[model samples]
Target chain A: MSPLSTLTPRTLKKPSPARSRLRGGARYAPTLATVGLFLAMFAVGAGMYPSFLSGQVFLNLFIDNTFLIVLAVGMTFVILTGGIDLSVGAVVALSMMVSATLLQQGWNAGAVIVLVLLIGGGLGLLMGLIIQYFDIQPFIVTLAGMFLARGLCYVISLDSIPVTEGFFTGMAQAQIPLSGDLFVSPGVLLALGIVAIAFFVLHHTRFGRTVYAIGGNEHSAMLMGLPVKSTKILVYALSGLCSAVAGILFSFYSLSGYSLAAQGMELDAIAAVVIGGTLLTGGTGYVLGSVVGVLVLGIVQTFIAYDGTLSSWWTKIVIGGLLLVFILLQRLFARKAG
Target chain B: MKSLLKHRLAWPVIALAALLLLNQIFRPDFLGLRMQDGHLYGSLIDIMRNGAPTILIALGMTLVIATRGIDLSVGAVVAIAGAASCAYIAASPDPGSPVTAATAVLIAVVAGLALGVWNGFLVSTIGVQPIIATLVLMTAGRGVAQLITGGQIISVSNDHYKSIGAGYLFTLPISILITAAVFALAAVLTRRTALGTLIEAVGINPVASRLAGLRARNIIWIVYIFSAVCAAIAGLMISSNVTAADANNAGLYIEMDAILAVVIGGTSLAGGRYTLVGTVVGAFIIQTLTTTVYTLGIPPEVTLVFKALVVITVCLLQAPKARNLLNRLKAAPKPAAKEAAKEKVAI
Candidate 1:
């Protein structure tokens, strides 16, 4: 029997509450915990600030975190396959730089968008191919890719490029009114659309299942005749595509491209994925959970901001603490499952 | 000679020599050194001085990576150590006193030890993956440093403290002497005793080693603490050099450079065998590369690309697949003869 199959109990036995809890809620415990935390934090915020409970305040959370949401969605796929893509942040910066530079040069906005997406996808594909063919560790390969992409960004320009194109600015300003004093921007809508597609693809597609299988056990997946190589590469490609879209959203939000933009964003995305109940070890997670994770992060930042006296650096410390807690929680569930 | 050529240190040593040669070609006086008022003065000395921090960190990283683990928080630890030390000294009534410097160093060392213990607990006791475990501190450490400094850069004007980084000892940079002493101590401790074998055994097969009565957890824990201490000292060197603790930029990306140094020195990230000498060479190579970049008139912003390119080249050269391919090519020209020779040797 394969090592993976050996992980499952072969003998029939009576189930205890602990065992049943391990079998049932273990997979969802982290997500459930995340939801509970978010709600509790929200309650605290609402209690602390009367204005924090408004529809506009919540809408602003989605709008502000749209870029992170999109990035996390892509990161979810990579993490699901037991791989990591540290190049996402660098790719985002590269895309922003490329898009801003092109738009500043009077290039068509549509063409620039397509080109940026292609660049991101191409870079991911290259890194994926290197990882697949050369059998290099994903961490090291992605680290190299991160360096390369960041270097390329500097090669393009060291200074921030302000995007003045009408299409870009208009997209930034475009908003859809929902209720009284509440509205959503195009970036938020795009983020939601990406999340929906990611959810559908992850849940309903053969490729997505293959990705999960690969993460669960690459050797077993290969023995089972899954398209491990292609799926692995495609997972990175999809992540790259998502990063590109997120980069465009970021540009639309900020209307400028700075080389220093999105520094440490990959860590943020990883934190969100972990917080949302997705296992960093891979195999069991949901894209939607990652969305919740992003929201949790956004809410924490919002709370800190609302406090009015806390330093912005507190957000990092809080997030780091949350990441540690969630990781320990995941470890507990994993131990119980085993 | 053939066996010597096959040694792992051969490549890094050769790479370092090649870089020095390149420097020499670019500037004939690159190798020139002179004594001025009892201290050596030259570009070579500068490389040794500047490379000291990296060498110290890489020495610790070598052991961590050898144990099938990594410490991503070392860079952050550097910041924390620097922040703590500098904060102490800056607040001291007499910052220039040796007592203040010694006390500050003690604070930094204690802070590093605490952080290392925390990391060790998370990885060994809690069974957290080393990367994620250290990453927690890596993320929060800078914030802690910022808090220590109250979100401001604290600069010190302590002559004694500055000498730790920039002072000369026996015509050598004090930083270089400190790094060498640490390296020699590590080399003796690991090699003279059974500790090296135990570390290797734990790295190669923890389960088997544990069953064989080795304290894998203790070994892992000690290595992390050692790494953190190394990072702390390196942090002191860095902050002392500049006489300022800018939490935001202190030790920024030094982890990457240290990791690269370890890998370039022929230490596999997968963990197993390691070489301290190779790590030292690797550190020098990296420092030399940075110096070379500036000497070549490359813009500071574009220098990272050059560094990346060189790292990629070195990594590709060291990869197992590339090595196998090269061996195959070497044998292909006389496959029949090579086969006969192999058969004879086997018989």
Candidate 2:
């Protein structure tokens, strides 16, 4: 027999149960790190500003980061499958523009929202199809999608359209009192619902496991007879749905939809996903981790605002630093696991 | 004739020629050039001058993409380089002096080198994905530039500095001259030396190249650094032409333009096999398209829509599946048995 055959059989043997468990734990280490980092940052903020320790302050994190949380959750699904959707920000902008334009034309708000969501989903499906069938890189295909969506947004309207209908305004103003001084808006509740649903879908479904398998090794996943094509397409479609939801929430948040809204928000989502412990290379991440990542970003911005003397741009710098550190940590974990 | 038609650059060159023809049809004087003082003046000259920055960046991108890697941080590097050089000039005791201007350029180029090293280290040594690694810089580099410029656009009034961007040299735009010199230098360095083959080898198969005793890591590292330095020079040209450094807007979307140029020039984003000549033609096509948008009286806001349409068309046409479909269409109505044989061979 060839030496290769001898070595192959030895390596192909199943790993020990304990060793496999260790590997599994190693996979979640980055997510755990993200959680720890979030807590530490929150604690530091509370120490710096006593007001930050209140329930109201905590609620504000969710309220402020509602759109980002939705985007991050959607991005997590895409990233988990070892693909990326750079068009999320542009799709968000397009959805906002479409909804706002229809709303301004006196269309029913509910009908408009559904229409926008479909448009977003369809666009994502198109990109997913091209990327899957044509063997194109996700980066280029999504980049093209970004340009197309942004261009379409501009084609729809060059100026911001304010939504003054009772439906949108009521949604924007509606709030649930959490305590004496804190309240959660409809947008926040919607974002939390998305997070919960994403958590369930990612952790409890075979489709989710298949996504992980594909990220781990596409060829192996194929050999195992997993439906790689459908799952990949579904991941992008899910991301598109999430972007549409986030855009609707943003409309409620700002009460206006401009073509330029959510500029660079995709990067922000990617950064959040990375910080939350989702590996850029895919296969290991948590939905809850991504929510924590969004909170981390929101808290950082709040802290900067409270400081009053610091530049707001410091938020970006801090996020960039966090991304670098987490990516490095991922490298370390990967090395140890190997 | 068939072989000539099959040349990699044939499509891009034809595209460029078609654009020029379209321009000429609209404006009779599109090709007319007259000596204004010692400098040439015409639409063609404008195309070269405006396309210089893109040509510079795409030249570097060609090599980087050839190595199965990408440098998305070039746009951020452009902003930072402009910020650094302009800030230095704005603060100098004698901003108008040649020495000060030289110092500013040196500082900007050095900043580029440092940023390149950082990217190289992250990607080559630490094993971060290129997109994510460059993204770290892309996100933060703008903030760093903002810090350098004190959250303001730094405007300078120096003839020597302005000349690098807006001035003419030997009856040609200095920007065009610089682009040409850089292109020639890169062609010589890559083709004359063994660097081109090594980069292609690594790109084609990193593990195989490493096993064959090539320094893959070093090659990867050098390309990232070279890409950044080229972006830095382009940044200087932009800021110099405007005589101001707007950190927020400087070199925005430039990376996309460079990548598109490289792709349109028939270079594969999947890595390996690049052409400098094709890149030059691609850059001219992009610049010409921008000029056409203006000449056609298309709204500036919708220019991106047209650009996206063109990019999609080019990419689809270049896709293997699309090409095969087109070939099959052309072969329809031929002998069925021969077609079946061809299909079998393809499979």
Candidate 3:
């Protein structure tokens, strides 16, 4: 269906295989830049802090950032479809709140998890329907979704609910030893598993290609007979499902469900995705780049923690600066390619 | 009457009146006005006074949105402005003096202007998407604000400064007066000159506008700067009203509220057309809705749910797809109704 139709070169002439490889490499420029930056920062930390070189410290980054990685994976899907989901952070909180309340009510832990995930996905589906059917702007629709989810959280409980369920607390305390000294939490493993699945789904699936096609040019994708509507809707639903998983991980990490938990966490997930090299305009990025982005963020925080003198606000400044640089690089690359 | 009904602002104005009526039904004395010591007092006045900040911000937002851009950093700008001014006031030799108050206001406005310039540069010069460009400041601005205030809640007992927010002038809140003045200025600047047309041109089609000899970048720059300055002025009012600058909480989610107000006022988010009058009415409607919740004894926290409902409903009503669906439904129902006409006519 496709082999003969693609014979016409996009440019003046078809590129040689090496030239194609070079062009492909250039497309990964932002992700590569992020990877390089992460390494440089790691080197700086290694030179400054003796403990930073420890293998456990590297594992700890995954442990502490488990929820973020999961959320960024979800965000990667939404951004890949040329949409943004501002409701992810709020949905995460809503999931946590529901889970904590249900647990306190003596509901089965597994049942609670499934129900909260469904709730998250349902809310996302509703937003997606509204956004797609009504043709409303994604940001405005997601913004309302954010308000609704956060409001529902307050309605559930204004106070933080401690998740003392036997299953939850047990999972929270459980750790898997990878070697003599290296260990990771159950949540870390769950997050990593999700990332692996996401990497495969995004790269190997037709849905993944459709997402990129839509992002590149939605009208053209529609004309090409792609299931644009359902894909767009499903992307948001996928993001919501991921957010619910992150919420569970977040609750495990903190061992409580606060109404205000994960406030602006969507921004963190987006920042990671952006810094990892996904263009905010959508399409042309890797899930692995996002993982590197999360690692970079974790290292920056660790560096500040080691310094001890810098205030917590420095984290915000550094992240903001990094976002600016990565976005500018993307702009430059886009200019050159276009 | 028909002309009045056809006016662009009719719906928002009617919505505002309906909200007031609803509040009156909840509280019998809701709409009552009283005068004491030559000053007027009423819920109506309170709505205007309390909504001044939102109204001011929404006016600038109208322009920015018209240029097909958004300023997410406005809320952050609010925090920085209040933090800067309050810190300066608290450090002044005479914190309560009028001169000190004037200096504080000037400093805050200047800070806002500078922030606007940064936003404008990022969008216009660096060519960052407006949402992402402003987002950089949105994330970092609070950090800057906390830095200015040294991470403390700065409070000043300055009467002159307080007057800007809480005090009255000619029986009306000074804040209301300030808002009215700014609204007038924006209206004149846009309507009296070619700025409004140029803005709409850029917003409608930047490339075409550029080809047609319009300075799209300058228009984008101006709107962003205007938005930032408006947010700063609103920040001053908020801080001056309470005589305190709480960096963390001041203007939190205000950008959302301002954007909502702008949208509800009949301005399309897609940009091109805007209504300043409608925006003011929208802000007033929002303020009344909040007050109405309090009067009905609904926990104000649930107001977010109500806001979400309102924004979605408004957007849906504005959406062309919704209308298309409505037409399809109508088309489906018409034949069935026509077929039943004989039976109905016999009845």
Candidate 4:
């Protein structure tokens, strides 16, 4: 036998039951943390500002914050695969620009939506191909993608264009029926549907397992015969599709699309993902965690809004603090895992 | 001579030729080199002068990356350094005092060193990923700088402070001189000592290097401290040139620019190998691109797209896997086609 085989024979053994249990618990930590944080937010908001407990307030939250939640969900998949998609915010701007342009030309909402999704997905597919085939670093590739997409947005429109299409206006203005005057928009429902789909795909699918494997160890996964490159490409495409959806949702609230749309929003998505306990280095996270992360971020802004004295810049400081904490936690967990 | 012509530098030279050709096609007078007032003056010189900051950052970045790590906080450290320098001068006991210049420079350098050590602590001791660890400071360092300056631009009227940026030596700009001095010192230090070998060993495989009895942590710390010092020098140049320190936008997007320069010069962000010379060339490329954009009448907004295209192309060229694949694709169809044609003739 070869020397490698001799070494492998000495190393090959199944994990112990206690170790397995620990791994399982670690896997669920993010999901549990997200739920726990959400509940904590609700309790605090209800206790301190009782108006925040009402269904009407929640509906408003859904209307205003759904775009961020969608972006975070998409970022979760990218992060799980140990890659970052800095281009998502830029792509959102591009998607919105496409939607606005098509709407201006009197295109139907269905056609416009499909076109935006296709453009966004196509851009992501190109970026993914560049990364996988060229073996370039994801961060640099995505940084370039960010520049490319934002430039495309500028090429399309230098200024914000207000949407006038009937379908867009109607859908954006439409409110969900609720008891005692509470209401939500269709965009909120769409965000919920997307998030639910992402959770299911991430938790229950073989593809999800492949992603985790790839993120955990690309070389090992390749040795194990996983289709690593194709899976990575698919995940980036999925992220782009989600970003497109979020772009449309954003239009419902902002009512316009400009080259500057979603400026500095990638930072927000990353912050939410980390706060919800997603590791930046990959191989671990939950979609729900990203959702809670978004909610936490939104609520922090709401609290800051309540206090009229603090500068908006304080939000960046607070988010930076949370990022440091989460990063520290990730480091600790990484050491223990090793 | 033939083998020398086939070196890796050939591609960059060819790319440069192609760029010059493109410029000639688009703007006829782009390649013009003229002497004005006993000084070599042209768009090329301007690119070099402006790109000097990126070159300095890339020099320091080369050391950090050589140790298989990154420093995303250099930009923020730059703002802090500039703010501290300007603040010291502006808040001196005597306005425009000679002591102000010396004290400010000293304080700025020390602050940079302190921040660099803090970054090193997070990565080496806390075991944080260099990217994430440096990111914490990248965010907070700017704020710290702003807080020191009381969120205002502090103007310095001192001749000494101004000369650090605006002074020229024998027709060469001071910024260029500073860039050269730092790079030369770094090149000498690494080449002359065991530091480069230790850094490469650690970067290629940290655990194995550690097992071999190298102090990986100490090297990582030293490199970060070195990077901070380099950034401090660049910050002083900017503050002195402008004669004012604006904390908010002092070194905005510089980290990205530095990273691009490093990557373009063929330094792998994944670590192990380093090229100080390549970094200098990369800085020149970026500077020339910026100058070309303005000279060619392209709008400032479109410059990003141009930059992105260049980066993608350079990255594709530098990637061995991509090159091998392309070669395979080129050679692949020939054998298959020959076999098919022979089979047809036999039939």
Candidate 5:
């Protein structure tokens, strides 16, 4: 103890400022690149369209993509643990279908929400258990889960069910006003709240650190006595819960639930997470980065919408190209780190 | 009998037979074959003909997965190939001419090869995850296809083009024949050469293989190109058969079917050790299962649920933990003396 006390302050001086800055630069480069890209794209949009720079338009980015924000947040937690959940889109659709069916049957909105979340989380928990115990690939397991959830959606009803529930309708139209007459939807606010919680849990909690440790190296994490199994399972469960919440938000946005709702949305969520600078190989990401990723996508949609002459298919092409660019950047960064 | 039970193809063969039996039980004509205009027409023929595109794609996928990579862009590649060919045919002055059809096929193949190269470059050279690399194309490929088709379903009535997918030659469906030729080519390339071993070696351990002087990157690149080409051919077969190129729906979800086929055929998703024969059986089983679902009339969409169950069951059967649990369940019914005997033998 005496030797440790003597050696502590002098011997344990912080790293050189230059070296620390270099380390920080490498760690935050992708995220900064994403933010710069988003800002650059916004600047281009604002220059092109007179109405693109409004507070409402900016807030609309958050409003229109509340569901995506939630889904990407969930995908972040799962991806951080080096696993993927392909079933999120399907689970969202399932949750919507279940909520819609229940609400139409005169069930309470609160109960419907709880039930749907339970279903989605149950599916995720099952998939995680099978993945952990049976040693199955997460991709295949989640693919099956995707199939199951989508099939269940069709089983619920072949048509779109209108959400006649007062609570959903009220929430859908509810606006939380900001300064200068700008307002955001309740769903957007809710999504933002989730993002904040996710940010905290990911940055500060022991559970969050454990997830990063597992993603960095499962074998080492195990040797280091980290609860890899439980964390992995919980990560998936958290993803499912978020997906369910996204489904509820989606139902609010559309005021209806259809079997085919959110088709290919899982890809969008994954794209957003990746664009946010999260490595697909897992670890080294931020929940806030994922939120920024969602904003980037939202802004792209806004850009496309503002340019009315452009077709909708261009959005896909642009997104695909952007994905390529970001993935290359990630590869370069990963190479540097390695 | 025990040897047959332990055979690799036993379950798939049995599954196929069971599906056929069920169909036969429901409708005796399910297995009936008739000759018309010197061409076979029957449920069995329909299964093979309809499943050709999937089988062809699966052949490519087998090699790709054997290299421990997946190409989700195959479906998108299919759509693109179909769109390019159909668009070309639609624009051609002599649309009905065989020359035009030949030109269209060339265009499709070239487009496929180009996309394949892009995927291969990203995956092998840049060292991106195969899934993510292919996903880039999967997302945007349909849009590109739509662009080529001008967002319209281009229907071509060229007999030459039609024959590529639906035409019969020597009492056989040209689609089935095309598939067979491709299958034979893959078999010869993989089995008659060291390429298969090389691919498997790369898949089994990329780092070790690289250290051992194997060109894992090149092998991966080649497999991706091969897969894209296969997907391109499948696209031709599908669009040509329908005489219409639907950029939107063409090859939609075919990748899932191909993956399921590969998995059901006993190919591990973890990669390494693949069997083409098992894949063929798997394709037939899937086609048969789809056909069976229609016959049973439980809403065609419900087949996805059944498909999910099958995937889980097959995976569980292959999983070590499940197998161990199954063994324990089997032993729990036996006397303690039998258990002791088994333990003694294991020791």
Candidate 6:
């Protein structure tokens, strides 16, 4: 029997209620917590200024946070496979540059999008191939990928390029009206649709099962003939596609693309995925959890912003602290689970 | 002599010669050694001086990697140490006092030790993977540094601190001497002591090592603490060189370089069988490659792509399967076609 065979049956365990609650914290827990946190902030903001919780204020969250949701979805897929894509932020920068450059040359928006996706996916494919075929460490390979992608972005433009195309600007600025005082941005809907599709694919597809399998035990997955290398490569490619899509959302939101735009956003995506209860070692994660994680992070930042006294560096400190805590929690879980 | 020619170092020695030859052809001025102000001055010396931190990090990384673990937090620890020492100096009444210097060094070392302990505890007792454990510090350590500096770069004009990074000793750069001393100390600690054997045993097979009466956890803890201290020293060098503590960019991406140095030195990431000398040589190779790229007028952006290519090629050459395939291809070309077909189908 294989060394992992002993743990196979136990893998089907229905986590105890408390354990399930911990894992499910990203879903139900985040909602309640976010609501409570939001109300507290809203009350404080109202006390400081009476119109802090206005409809426009609420709409700002969707406008500002839509790109993060898309990025988080891509991160979720990568983490589900027990791998990471540190190069996502770089890919976003690269894709944005590609789109910005192409659009400047009068290429059709559709063509620009296709070009960015193909380039991003091609980079991802190269990274995945190196990592899988050469048996190189994923972290190093992705680190190199990060450098390569970011370098290309710099080579395209050393600084920010304002996206001047009217149609591109209009598409990015387009807003969707909702009932009553609430309005949803098109980017928000796009992010939500991607998340929903990600949920369906992860929970209801054989490919998702293969990802879980690979994360659980690569050797076992190989023995079971589960197309391990192809799965690994495909997930990276998906991550690249997601990054490109997020780049579009970001460009629409900001109407600019800069090489340094997403310098450290990869860390945010990582923290979100981990906070959502995804194991860094792979296996056992949910896309919805990542959405909640991103919201939690976003809300925390909003709270910090409302304070007006804290430096932006506090975001790093808070995320870093929470990351440490979640990692410790994961360690504890692994110890108990082991 | 014949056996020495067959030694592992022979490959790197030959590679170094080839690199020099290539440099002489492309940039002949690179081999032009000279002396200035009673000090040896040349590209080689410049490489050593600038690469002091990397070489120091790689030596410690060698020991850590030997335990089948890595220290991604070293770069962060460097920032933390730099911040700690700088803050201590800036806030002190007598920054030039020996006591202040000692206290600052002590405090920085202690902080780094504490950080390492947290990482070790997570990896050994709490069962977090080494990479993940160190990653926590890798992310948080910078935050701690930022918090220490109050989000500002702290500048110091202390001669004592400056000497550590830029001062001369016996007509040579202090950084070089400090690095050499640390390397020697590491060599003695690993080669002249049983600790080295224990670390190797633990790395090779922790369970077996434990069954054989070794405390693998304690060993891991020691190695982490050691790695952190090395990072502290590097931090001192960096801050002293600039006479200011720039927490934001200090030791950025150093972890990658350290890993690269260790790998190029022929040390396996899978652990066991430490290579102190090889790692030092690897550090030299990386530093030389950087300088070479600059001298060759390659744009800084293309440097990373070039590095990526080099690292991939190195890893492929190191891969056993690749080596076997190479051998098989050389012996019988027919199997190469078959293997290529298999790879295409697999993709």
The Cα RMSD of model 3 versus the native structure comes to: 3.6
- Enumerate the chain B TM-scores of all models: 0.97, 0.96, 0.93, 0.90, 0.95, 0.91
Which number leads on DockQ?
Answer: 5
* Model 6 per-residue lDDT tens digits across residues B11-82: 556666676676678887878877778777788788899999999988888888999998988988899899
* lDDT of every model, 2 decimals: 0.90, 0.89, 0.90, 0.82, 0.91, 0.81
TM-score for all models, in order of appearance: 0.96, 0.95, 0.96, 0.88, 0.96, 0.89
Model 5 lDDT tens row, A141-162: 9998998999899888889999
Best-to-worst order by lDDT is 5, 3, 1, 2, 4, 6
True-structure RMSD, every candidate: 3.1, 4.0, 3.6, 5.6, 2.5, 5.7
Which parts of model 5 have CA positions greater than 4 angstroms off? A1-21, B331-347
Per residue, candidate 4 scores C-alpha lDDT tens digits across A181-268 of: 8788888889999889988888788788888888788889989889998999988888888788889888877778899889768878
List where candidate 6 sits over 4 angstroms from the true fold.
A1-59, B1-13, B96-99, B333-347
Clash count (model 2, backbone only): 0
**Clash pairs of candidate 5?**
none
Residues B1-347, model 4: lDDT tens digits: 77865665655556656666776778776677777666667666677778877888888888888887888889888898999999888878775767778888899889889988998998898888787788777766776777777888989899878878887777877888888888889888887888888888888899999999999999899999999888888888888889999888888778878888888877788888887887787777777777678768888778778988988988988899978987788878689787888999999
What does candidate 3's lDDT look like per residue over A1-338, in tens digits?
Answer: 46754785667345567787877988988999998998898888889888788889889899999999999999998998889999999999999999999999999999999998899888888988888888899999999999999989988889999999999999899989897978999998899899999988888888989899988899999999999999999998889999999999998988898889999898889999999999889878888999999999999899888899988888888888898888889999998888
Per-residue alpha-carbon lDDT of model 1 for A1-338, expressed as tens digits?
55775675656334555676766677888889998998898888899899998888888889998989999999999999999998899899999999999998899999999999998888888878877877777888788888888888898999999999999999999989986767999899889999998889888888989988988999999999999999998888888888899899999999999988898899899999999998888998889899999999999889888888988888878888999999999999999778
By DockQ, is 2 or 6 better? Answer: 2
Error of 1 at A220 (Å): 0.7
Two-way lDDT contest, 2 vs 5, winner: 5
Give me the runs in candidate 2 sitting further than 4 Å from their true place.
A1-17, B336-347
lDDT of each residue in B41-139, candidate 3, tens digit only: 999999999999999999999999999999999999999999999999999998888999999999999999999999999999889988899989988
Tens-digit lDDT track of model 5 for B94-113:
88998999999999999989
